[model samples]
Every structure is written in structure tokens, then in C-alpha cells.
Target: MDAVSEIPDYVKRISFIDSNYNWDNERYGDKLQKWLEASSDNRLFVACYDDANALLDGKPFVSKTGGTWHRTYLMQRYLKKKMKRLSWNKTENDSIIYFTADNRRIQFYSRKNPEQKIYHTILVERNGYIQSVFSGTKYEGMGYQFMGRKVYDMYRQNSGSW
Candidate 1:
């Protein structure tokens, strides 16, 4: 099983939008910085899960060992570190935002899930105001229960008519 073929369909669909742009660019950097500064106190939901367990945290979360929980924890840490650095890029319409980082060899159980993959982080600003970050792995699906009704409603509404 080649790695590329093993990637889930959903992951492949989103691969095009993965952060290829240089977030270090001055203009994008400024916009990202401003957004981060304004959103410093806003609520953030970190939802992670796998075949057997799920965890949600207001702050970043990560597991110390390699297991179903490792991906979620790694994602949390990745997002937090990126937020601290303000390392993100905006889409052409400025409606969607993204951040990505190379996993390197820091993954849990490096023997199996080697660190060659890239983690994709996604964020959206609701009603031109509040911003929320979402990260998840390809297998177990992204958990959304942690987001309050208002936020969930906003997400559903903006997401589509469904």
C-alpha cells in the first residue's frame, strides 16, 4: 500500500488548498497578525477523536503516546504554535484561512506513522467577526460537538443550506 494511494478521498480533495503560499509574506503576515491579535480572547474549540475515543478542549490538547489520540494532540500543538507565530495564509477571497506544517519525525510511534506528512489546519470567520479553528485527521472524522449551539449554527448556516 503506497502512502499516496492510502490517503483518504477527503484528504485528497482538500490537498489543493493546502498551504503552499509563503505565509511569511509581508502582506499576508500583517493580515494574519491583525486577525490573531483581535481574536486572542475568543473561544477556541479543539475537537479530536479516533476509532475508540474522543477529546475536546478549550485549549490545545495532545496525547503523550502513539495511539488513536496522537493525531488530535499533535494537531492541537501545531495550531497553538502556529497561532503564537501568526503563521497563516488567507485565501484569495480572504474568507478562508489555512496553516500547515511538516510533521518531521516528531510523531508518536515514528516507526508506523512517520513524520513525512503535512498537517493541514483550517479556520473560518463567522459573520465577518468571530473566528474558529478546526483540525482533524482523515479517518475518524472531525468532532464538532464541542462548539456551542450558536457557533455550530453559524457554521452550519455559512457552510450551506443543509
Candidate 2:
């Protein structure tokens, strides 16, 4: 187990997803760092695409949005470039897919309408964290809970561009 200070403060029992699918260098770096800190990545279990070189080759991302295809062009391109970072594998099983990481096995999923979407959405997450994408100025996120205290997105968030 990591020391409390070493771990990023994740939203317990809840997760948020920002549907924007944004990509900015600083934001990307920040998000990546946070993810590495919170995720189950050690030396052996292996994270899919943390390495920049691997990303250039393009890993496994959703070629198809199993539910709602509401992604912007920028989002699509970003996914193509950094899709592997989002998922551990390309194999599609069901809505909730599990992958083993550093310390434990984690699952990745999204809040999409099965009636509308294809099935799988994006990838990557923690037990108590908010999974958001940068939207240039701010993070556009969606909130979901799988484990501890409920994550309320509206609390720390405010309206308008900062």
C-alpha cells in the first residue's frame, strides 16, 4: 500500500467522466501524472500505454463508440493518438471490462445508454476518482460511483470559463 500522501485524493465510491474528450499538453501531463499515482501500476502488472513511444504506435482504443458517438473531431484525433493510454487491451467483452494493473484488478466503463451506444466507451479509472477530459479551459466531466463516498461533481465545480 502507498502512503496516504503518495496517493492522489480520489472520489471515493464515485467517478466522474468529462465527455469532452479534450487534449492539451499541460492537461494531458497533469492527468497522466494523477492517473499513475492512483492507478494499480507497479512494475509487473503493467499499464498499457504510459510510455510516449508506445502511444506513437497507437494502442487499443474504441474504434467504435458502442453507445453515443458524440465525440468532437478534436476528441477523435486525440483518441487515435492516445487511445492506448485509455485502455489496457483492445478486446471487447461487455459494458464493464476488467484488467489487471500494478496492485489490483480494475474495471473501466462509461455512463452511456446501451440503447444508443455500441457498448464500450473509453478506458481507465480508479476506485475513487473522477475521470475527466480537459476541455481547453476547464474539465468537462461525468460522475459515476463504483465503490466509497459518493462523488458530487457540482460541489467543487463552478460555471463559466475560468
Candidate 3:
């Protein structure tokens, strides 16, 4: 396995919020920093645990992977369950979150099985504090996917990603 895959499940989740965000932020932030800076060799580990707990408790998901949101086991489970009822051709029957390198696409993968060979796409747009989401299928003629193109035309007459 790769080095990243070797990290414990819990340690895979980490959040590095700036210390100047809110009340008691300093104390909490300092504690987090201490764990993160515990040792360079295991830095990712400490942060992952800290971030995982924070996320499980309802805080925003954070990651050193440059992702805007983190995905926990619970969230993954929930997504998987939701996907079953959504009627999308999914090959992987597990719940997964996909965050790209450029941070342009943040996707939640709902699989019908672990292989995730095929699935639906749910697109979401986020501003500073609000998020707008849309869902669609992979095949337009199949009626299982979203008719994203039709929705786009209502607003703009130009071509869309759908």
C-alpha cells in the first residue's frame, strides 16, 4: 500500500482552520497545532484524528489534501444508502467523496457496490456560506440521470456541462 493508505482510518481526517476564526479559537487552535506539529514524520496522523473528531461532531470537513470538505465513514455510509434509492447505475456500492486537485469539483459518490463501476453524479456549488446542489444520471436517454441540460437552458441559452 502507499504511505497515505497506511494511515489509520481515523487519522485520514484532518482540519487546519486558521486560529483567528472565532471565540476560544486560540486555545482550541493551539491544541490542534500542537498535535499537528507533534512530529513531522507523523504530522498527517495527528491532524487526521483531530479533524475526524471535529467533523463527526458536526464541524466542517477539512483535509491537508487541499480539499474544501472532508468525508467521514458515517457520511460515506449515509451517501451510500441514499444512492440505492436514487436509481443510478452504480458499480461501487460504497459511499465516497471525491475532491479534485484543483478544488473545482467536490463530488459525493454513492455506489451500488464497492467497485463503483457506474454511478450518478450530484453537482454542488458553494459560495462562502451557502451551497446549491443538483443531481442527474449518467445517461440522458435512460431517464435515470438528471436533465441538467434542460435546466441550464432555462437560465442560459449556451451549452452546459450536462
Best by lDDT: 2
Those runs of model 3 whose alpha carbons end farther than 4 Å from true positions after fitting are 1-62, 65-69, 72-74, 78-90, 93-122, 125-150, 157-162
Model 1 bad stretches (over 4 Å): 1-17, 41-162
- Which lDDT value does model 3 have at 159? 52
lDDT tens digits, residues 83-110, model 1? 5653432222221122332221011111
| Cα-based TM-score, every candidate | 0.21, 0.26, 0.20
lDDT of each residue in 1-162, candidate 3, tens digit only = 123323343442232221111213223334433333343322210001223223323443444322312322233233334334322232232342332111111123321223312111222111100121211112213322321333332444455555
Q: Which portions of model 2 show Cα errors greater than 4 Å?
A: 1-15, 18-20, 23-27, 34-92, 98-100, 105-107, 111-114, 117-162
lDDT of each: 0.28, 0.31, 0.26
Error of 3 at 19 (Å): 21
Order of candidates by lDDT, top first? 2, 1, 3
Give RMSD to native, each candidate. 16.6, 14.1, 18.4
Which candidate do you rate higher for TM-score, 2 or 3?
2
Over all chains combined, what TM-score does candidate 3 have? 0.20
